[model samples]
Target: MTVYALETSGLTKQFAGFTAVSDVGLRVRRHTIHGLIGPNGAGKSTCFNLLTKFLAPTRGTILYEGADISRAGPAEVARMGLARSFQISAVFPHLTALENVRAALQRRRGESFDFWRSDRILKRYDADARALMAEVGLTGWEETLAGEMPYGRKRALELATTLALAPKMLLLDEPLAGLGQEDVGRIAALIKRAAEGRTVLMVEHNLNVVASLCDVITVLTRGKILAEGDYAAVSANPAVQQAYLGEMAEPAHV
Candidate 1:
């Protein structure tokens, strides 16, 4: 197997002659949490879209497990063991947490939505979804309406839903955007725990969160990578400091 979970070379994207992401490159090693941090409009989301097959790259190649997945459609990419979370919450608001997760498990199992399936057959899915709910700290909330959950827990539910897909790689976009401190802590821990032997790539505005969770950090600006290294080195880069307006721990290079 390829040592890196994801590798991109000379990746670029353009919109009507405007370069949105240019000559970006990255290498995310297998079984580690990798952070992609940048300011708003820095092409963080755009890069993610290209990775997940939501957008086509204007140039370059994307290799996942040594296979080119850049041109693959979203479903095809997902079936290759890649799953993603949107910057906005994606969930079933009306269903109970259990039902929501069951839906995802059902989709992954390739079973018809036979609402008439004997309760016995459905129980098998329920059993699977419950385990995911428990893993995400929704063990007690399994029966709660997903719409009734708080913002953070709802995000957890979203994670659980994706977990139903049994992904080997995860792409999380702004996972902490609207979370409270407590909820952020919970979800961060969950992500870290679930990361065992799986590749996690995240785009975060909060450098603190990224610094703590990421084994490697890639700094992006104006659609290209400015620097990439461990926290200490990347944080010390003058270019990254300049891009984040010196809000980060290290000073920018002059």
Candidate 2:
């Protein structure tokens, strides 16, 4: 059996009196894709926020590589090799695709990105960035302005930037949100290629993507774990049917 690369036990988040997340226990195995699925307001994003250290958990613990990491800050957690991709794609619009990736590389390598350096000295960085861009299938678009690129290419660049951070476990938040079918497939392939040797946990609403890519599924409802297992097993659970599947099921199935 696969051991977990990341696990959260009894994770909780509260906003004033309302509990936004309630004891979300998660286990993401090493080198596997794990999916979190729930309706809007079901606390999927809050769980990601807690894991990414954007929100302080009101209760419980998070363990990474067998040590505690729940209270760590965002940058601290990132340094520990866990990074998040937002629901919305984020890139430097004014920069070329290559420049955007190089910036991320510079940040990761602790290099100053100031103009004090000669243009010739930046080639090493460019080489590194270009390799990552090509890995993400952005080879020829290196010189294109990020804002000028098509939407999917921009997102592919977004993943390349994240990949440049050298994360060990990636927390992807709604990576396919707002994308059409073709774009989704393209990005999905990028994500699959990205997960080759690391852990990936994502909050996803697309049942097809989750069913196709994830090795395990964690279903959330009302801020708690409703079900978890392989896709078929979780989808067959009665509580999931009541809380989530009713709305998510096809009309004929409903």
Candidate 3:
């Protein structure tokens, strides 16, 4: 049996009387890119929140590398090497790309905020931050404010900041949500490069990106698992096609 990097059994979440996620099981292999997809309101986001500990699970367990973390809070989970992106806007708009990554590194070290400090302490993070920025393909944009960057580059900056945390697994909620075709391709490549030697589980609506990039795809519908397989297998599933892809395939009337 292959040891999974992240696993969940009977994971569930309920808000008031409505169940957002119900009895879902997931097994994501180490160093692999996995895709979670569903129609709007399919509980994909809720599942992500639960995994990252943003929302406590009302029932079930979550295991990261075989350790149960069902009740762990967000900060606890993050300390355990699971990092989430795009949840709270990881990048600071006012800071330069390099500064944003430096800040994340500072936080990772549990460094206290010292408003009186000069660049001396901040300079120590510069080397590491610059390396991270280069890794995310933002080498020359170091001086540019994150907010001033192009839309796609800003997303890349956000990714660099997340990497400063040195996570074992990355939970990306819609990494490819907003972008033109060119940016889509660039970000896709960047994601593939970033997934090297780490586990990546993303919730994306772009089936093409998921189909092309993910090794395993899990389909969710109405708060339950509809299917789990490779892109080919899931795409060929008639039930999946009917429930999801069929809607995409329907032609607009002339």
Highest-TM-score candidate: 1
lDDT by residue (tens digit), candidate 1, 154-231: 999999988888999999989888998788778888889889878999988767778788999888889988888888
Candidate 2 residue-wise lDDT, 1-254, digit = tens = 33888888989999999998997778888999999988778888888888888999999999988879988888888888988899888999998999889888887887776635777876678888989999989999999999999888888999999999999999998998888888988888889999999899999888878888888989888899888898778777778777864754432120
**Which pairs clash inside model 3?**
none
Model 1 has an lDDT value of 0.87
Model 3, CA-based lDDT: 0.87
Q: Which regions of candidate 3 fall more than 4 Å away from where they truly are?
A: 87-89, 113-116, 245-254
For model 3, residues 1-254, the per-residue Cα lDDT tens digits are: 34798999999899999999999999999999999988888899999889889899999999998999998888988888999997334577887888889888987888865534799978899999999988888999999998898988988888988889999899998988777778888888889998999999999988788878999999998889999998878877788887774853432221
Model 2 lDDT at residue 90: 95
> Which candidate ranks first by lDDT, i.e. highest?
1
RMSD to true structure for each model, in Å: 2.7, 2.5, 3.2
lDDT of 2 at 57: 96
Give each model a TM-score.
Answer: 0.95, 0.94, 0.94
RMSD of 2: 2.5
Rank all candidate structures by their lDDT, best first, as comma-separated numbers: 1, 3, 2
